[model samples]
Structures are given as C-alpha cells and as structure tokens.
Target: MIEKTRGIFLHAVKYSETSLIASIYTEHYGRQSFIINGVHGKNSTVRAAVFQPLYLLDLEIYYKAGREIHRIKNARITYPYSTIPFDIRKSTQVLFLAEVLYKCLREEETNIELFDFLYHSLTLLDLTEAGISNFHIWFLFKLTRFLGFSPSREDAERCNFFDLQTARFVSHEPLHSQFTDKHLTVLFTRLFTIDSSSIENLDYTQHERRLVLEKLLEFYHIHLGNLGEFKSLEVLKEVLK
Candidate 1:
C-alpha cells in the first residue's frame, strides 16, 4: 500500500551507478530508508537536488511493517530554502545538526510533536539573519526535551556546578570530570531559558560559545549510547571561527 507523508532528508549514499540509498525522518513513520533509483539517469523523475540534508519533502511511499527498506513513489520539496543552501554559515550549521540528528534519533514510531519542532526550527534557521551563530546551541538544548533528558532547573538558583552525567545541577563540583565548573553553570542557566527565536540574547563570546558547545556534546554523550565523535564538528568549528 502507498501512503503520503512529510519528511526531512538526513543522509544519502550512492548504492549503485545510478541509484542512492537515503535515510529520511518522516512525520508519520519516524526514520526510514528508501532506495531512490535512476537518480543519475537522464529521465529520472526524482532529482538528486531534493535529497539534501534537512530538506523538507512531501512524499508518497510504499510502507510495510518489518520491511528493511521502503520505496518512494513520489517526492517533492515542501519548502524551498531561501538561504540555508546559499549561505556558508547556515549550510554548515545544517550539516552539523543533520549529523547530530542522524546519530541520536533512532525510532520508527511516529512522534508528531518532535516532527513539528524540527520542521519549524529548520524553517526558522533558514529565515533568520542575525542569530545564525547561536542557532545550533538552541537546537541542541531544545532537542534534549524530546530525547527525554532535558536538564532540570529546580536547583538552578543556588547550584554552581552542572553535572553532565546526571543531567542536573550540583552544589559543589562533581567528583568525576563530566561536569562544567561554576562559571559555565551560570551560562547554562541562561541558555536553558533561551528559545531559537531569542538566541541572540544569550550573547556568548567565541570562547564561551565553544565551551557551551563542548558541554552540550558531553551531555549528549552521557545520555546516549554509542554516539561517537562528530565528523562535522571540526568543519563547523572552522567555519564559525
């Protein structure tokens, strides 16, 4: 049977001379893999341009439970990005965030709320002008809420240490090394209150931004199993600096 859904492209790799295997996260089915055939052929209906990372798509697919891979019957771009593909900084951010999503999200069941969050957030990133530098920070923090380990702020007022391993604040420094010092904890408190639309208000310096990004990755590592080092991190850091 064929079903229609909205999806976001995550990653793709060449499977044959004219075919590609693509991973897409969909609104009704979560993460799915599909083989797009004839992408390099002269008469291909589905162009390779529609499969870029984080691109929103409208799709008609053949889906079945227990199948290893599904086939796309039809696909079209739902929203064309105005600047994310053209601007170096925003496109780099898109790549980094796409890598993070590919690593951390692994569910087949539909999560409408999470899907909505991602769709709107990516749209916002494409539209925003002045706050692109801080967009990823807000995305990382907001994504935690969906992944079931958002940091608790109940102890924020008096706490001076952020325990990454435990996902909360502590009075004294953590005995283990998986924590931020008092200074970073203060910044973390401020970061938690910021949404994507208001990310500019955080106003972190380059040193501070790097520290926050490191801490955010640490927080993910502690909570998620087997999330290895990000290959895009080096490139993203170079681009940002």
Candidate 2:
C-alpha cells in the first residue's frame, strides 16, 4: 500500500552509480530510509537535487512495519527555498542542523508536534533575514524541549551555572566540566523565554554565538551519548566566522 506524507530530507549517500539511499523524517512516520533509484538518469522523476539538506518534501511511499528501508513511490520538494541555498551563512547552518537532526532524531514513531516544529523552523530559516546568526542556537535550544531534556528553569534568575549533566540551573558551579559559567548560564536560560515572534530581537556577537552553540552541543552530548562529532561543525564555524 502507498501512503502520502510530508517529509524533511536529512541525509543521503550514493548507493550505486545511479541510486541513492536517503534518510527522511516523515510527519506520519518517524525517521525512515528509502532507496531512490535512477536519480542520475535524465528522466528521473525524483531528482537528486530535491534531497538537499533539510529540504521539505511531499512523498508517496510504500511503508511497512519492521522493514529496515522503505520504498518511495514519489517525492518532490514541497517548498523551494529562496535564500538558504544562495546564502553561505544560512546554508551552512542548515547543513549543520540537518546533520544534527539526522544524528539525534532516532524515533521510529510519529511525533506530530516535533514534526511541525521542524517544518516551520526550516521555513523560517529560509525566510528570516535579521538574527540569522542566532537561528541555529535558538533551534538547538528549542529542540531540547521535544527531546525530553529541555533545561530546567527552576531558580534560573538565581543560578550562576547551568549543569549540563542535570539539565538544570545551578546556584553554584558544577563539579564536572560539562557546565556553563554565570554569563553563559544567563544566556542559555533566555532561550527558554524566546518564541518565534521574538527571535529577531535576540542578538549575539559572533564570538558569543559560537560559545553558546558549543555549550549547547555539549549539553546535547551529555544527554545523547552517541551524538558523536559533527563533520560539518568546522565548516559551519568557518562560514559563520
């Protein structure tokens, strides 16, 4: 049976001379892998271009439970990006975030809310101009809420440190190195209060932005032990610099 769903393209690798294995996160299902054939052919309906990082897609798939990889009957870009592919800053962030999502979003079941959050966020990333530097930092922090490890705001105003291991604001410095100092703790806590409407208002220098992102990734690594190092991290940092 074939089912239609919206999807976000995450990553893909060449499987053969003309075929590719792509990982996409679907709205109705979770993360799934599909073999796309004849992508290199002139008449291929689903071109390889549509599989670009974090591209929103409309898909018709042959889905079956217990299958390691499903089949895509049809796939096309849902919303063609206007700026991200053209702008290095925006494109680099998309590449880095796409890799992060591919690594951390391992759920094999439906999560409607999380799916919507991702879809809208990517759309916003392509459209928004102001505060582009802060977008990835905001996105990483917002992602924690859905991953079940959003930092605790308890005593946020009174805390001098953010304990990465515990995912909470601490009144004193943590014993371990996986924590934030008072300055970063204050910045991290502010993320919890920000929403899409106010995202443009949030500002940070390049250095400050990089520091927050590193701390955020550290927080994620502490919770998601297998996240590993990101190959795109250096490129993103270089582009943003």
Candidate 3:
C-alpha cells in the first residue's frame, strides 16, 4: 500500500551507475531504504538535491511490512534549507548530525516525537544564523530522551562523574574511565541551556570542544554497543577548527 510521510534523508549511496539507495527516516514509518533510479540522467538536479543527506522531504512511499526494502513513489522538498549547505560551518554541522544519526538510531518503532524533534532541530539550525559550534553537543543530549536514557538534572548535578557503562552519573569512577566532571558540566551547564545565539558567549577553546565531543562519542560507544568509527569526525573537527 502507499502512504504519505515527511522524511529526513539520512544517507544515500550510489547503488548503480544511474540509481541510488537512500536511507530516509520518516515520521510515519521509521528508517526506510529506497531505491531511486535514473538519478544520473541529464537535468536530474531536482531529484538529486532532494535526496541529499539530511534534506527535509515530503514523500509518498510504497510500503510493505516485513519487506527488507521499500520504494518512494513521489518525493519533494518539504523545506529547502537557506544556508545549511552554503555555509561551511552549517554544512559540517549537518554532516556531524547525519553521521551520528546513521550510527546511533536503529529501532524502527514508531516515534513521531523523535521525528519532530529532529526535523525541528534541523530547521532551527538552518534558520538560526549562529550558535552552532556547540550544536552536536546539544543534539546528542536531546537524543537521549528518545533512546529511553535521558539523564536527570538532579543526578547530573549531584554526581561527580558520568558513568558511560550505565548511561548516567555516578559518585565514583566505574571500572573504566568513561567521563569526567569537566565534560559533564559542559553537557549540563552549557548545552542544556544555551542556543545558537548564546553559543558564542559560552565558548570554550576549540581543543576543549573537540576533547569533550570525542569523550561523548566514547560514552556513546560504550553504552550503545560497538558503533565503531566515525570517518566524518576528523574532517568535521578540522573544519570547525
């Protein structure tokens, strides 16, 4: 049967000489794979850009439950980003979000809230002119709610350490060193409250942000199984710096 949905294109790969395989996260369904044929043909610019990573789209999808892969019948840009691609910082930020989502989000369970949060956040990033250096920090933290492990403020403030194995704060370090008080403060004190406009004021050194982000991803790997490598991290770090 056919259904309509608004989706965020997470990743796309060249499947054949002219076709592409795209992983799109839709509000009605979840993470869905689609095959688009004839993308390399002349004047395919319109279809090409619509499938770009993290692009917001309105789609009519041909879905069949229990099928390994589905197809998209009609897709159009629900919202065209004004500056996410052109602005280098915003472009890198989009890549960062895409990479993280590609790895961490797995469940196909219906989640309208998570979809809305992601969609709104992306739109917000494009519209808001500044305060994005700390965007991923906020992004990861917000995602915890959908993952069923959102850290509590009371525990976050009281604990001396972040226990990555347990995905919460602890009074003392666990068997392995997962997180420190410094990074916890950054996550709680700054990322929770600050927006793009306020990101400039809460600025830490680029080195500090990188270290904190690296540790955060480590925490994620520890808790969320072996989501081994992030190839985009190195480039994103270089670009942000």
Candidate 4:
C-alpha cells in the first residue's frame, strides 16, 4: 500500500545511468532507503534534485510490513532553502552534518522528539547568520540526550572533569582520560545553558570551536562503537581555517 509521509533527505547514490537510490529519514517510517527512477531525463532531473542533504520533502511511498527498502511513488520539496546551496560555508557545514547524521542515525523506529529536534536544527542552520560556526558541537551534545548518554551537570561547580569513556562528569581526571580540563570546561559550560535561541552570536574563535568539536568527536568515538573518523572532518577544518 502507498503511505504518505514527510521526510528529510539524508543522502543519495547514483544507482545507474538513469536512476538513483536515496536514504531518507521519514516522519513515520524512520530511516528508509528508496529508489527514484527515470531521474536522468532532463526535465525530471530537476525534480530529483530535491533529494539533497537537509531537503524537507513530502512523499507518497510504498510500504511493506517487514521489508527494508521501499519504493517512492511521488516526492516534492516541502521547502526550498534560500541560502544553503549558495553559501560555501553553509554548504560545507551541511555536508558534514549530513554525513554525521547518516552515520549516527540508524533506527527503523519512529521518534517524534528526535525528528522534531533535527527538523528545527536544520532550519535554524539555513536561517541563521554566518557566525554560527559552533553548531556542530551543540548538535553532538543535543544528540547525546536523545541517545540516552547525556552527562549529568548536577554539580557543575565541583565536577572538574568529564569522563568520556564512562559518559559522566567526574571530580577529577580519570586514569584513562579522553578530554582535558579545558576541553571539559568548554563542554560543561555549553551543556549547562546552551540552546539555539541563546546561541545567535559567537564569542569563541573559529579555531577554538574546531578544536572543541574534534575533541567531542573523539569522545564520541570512545563511547559509540564502530564510529570511524568523520570523512568530512579535514575539509571542514580547512574551510574554517
């Protein structure tokens, strides 16, 4: 049966000379892969272009009770971005974050809170000004809450360290440390009161932001299994530099 739902295009692959396969996180079905056919034809090629990173889409998709990959019946853009495609910095950040979501999200079960968080976050990226360089850092931290691994800031004044491997705030550095005091301080400060509303202006330098993000990724790798290095890390670092 055909089911209609909203989805966010996460990534796409060139399946053949005339077709493509896309991975989308749907509002109802969670993560799904779909094959979009006849996309290479000139007129329709533009239609297929809507399946880009962070594109919001309304879709009529064929669903099965237990099958993995589904077929898309119809799809169109829900909202075309105003500047994400044109701004080089925004484009780079979108590409990198898209890859991170592609790697980190792997659920076939629908989650309303997670879906809402990501949809809002992506829109914020498109609408925000240039100084929002530290989005990647906040994105990772916010995601940890949904993943059931958010660190407790119960005693921020006394918790001088963060035990990355154990995913908790510590009074002192552990024997096997993944982050230094400076790194922990930055993260702790952010964790206490950070949100999109209060983060419009950036006080931190680009270099400082990148360093914090890299350290956070290392912390994630120490905990999350099978997380290889983010492929776009070097490109993102270069762009920031």
Q: How many pairs of residues collide in each model?
A: 0, 0, 1, 0
In model 3, where is the ten-residue run with the lowest total lDDT? 182-191
TM-score of each: 0.97, 0.97, 0.90, 0.92
| Per-residue alpha-carbon lDDT of candidate 1 for residues 12-129, written as tens digits (9 for 90 to 100) | 9899999999999999999999999998889988889899989999999999977879998888999999999999999999999999999887999899999999999999988888
For 87-106, candidate 3 gives per-residue lDDT tens digits of 88889888877988988777
Residue 61 in candidate 4, Cα distance off native in Å: 0.6
Question: Each model's RMSD to truth, in Å?
Answer: 0.9, 1.0, 2.4, 1.9
Residue 93 in candidate 4 has what lDDT? 82
Q: Which stretches of candidate 2 lie over 4 Å from their true place?
A: none
lDDT of 3 at 189: 47
lDDT of 2 by residue, 113-230 (tens): 9999999999998889998888999999899999999988898988898889998888888788889998887778788778887888779778888889999998888898858889
The TM-score that candidate 4 achieves is: 0.92
- Tell me the whole-model lDDT of each prediction, alpha carbons only: 0.91, 0.91, 0.77, 0.78
Q: Residue 101 in candidate 2 has what lDDT?
A: 98
**Pairwise TM-score winner, candidates 1 and 3:** 1
Candidate 4 on 78-105: residue-level lDDT in tens?
8778888987777888888888888777
After superposing all C-alphas onto the true structure, candidate 1 shows an RMSD in angstroms of: 0.9
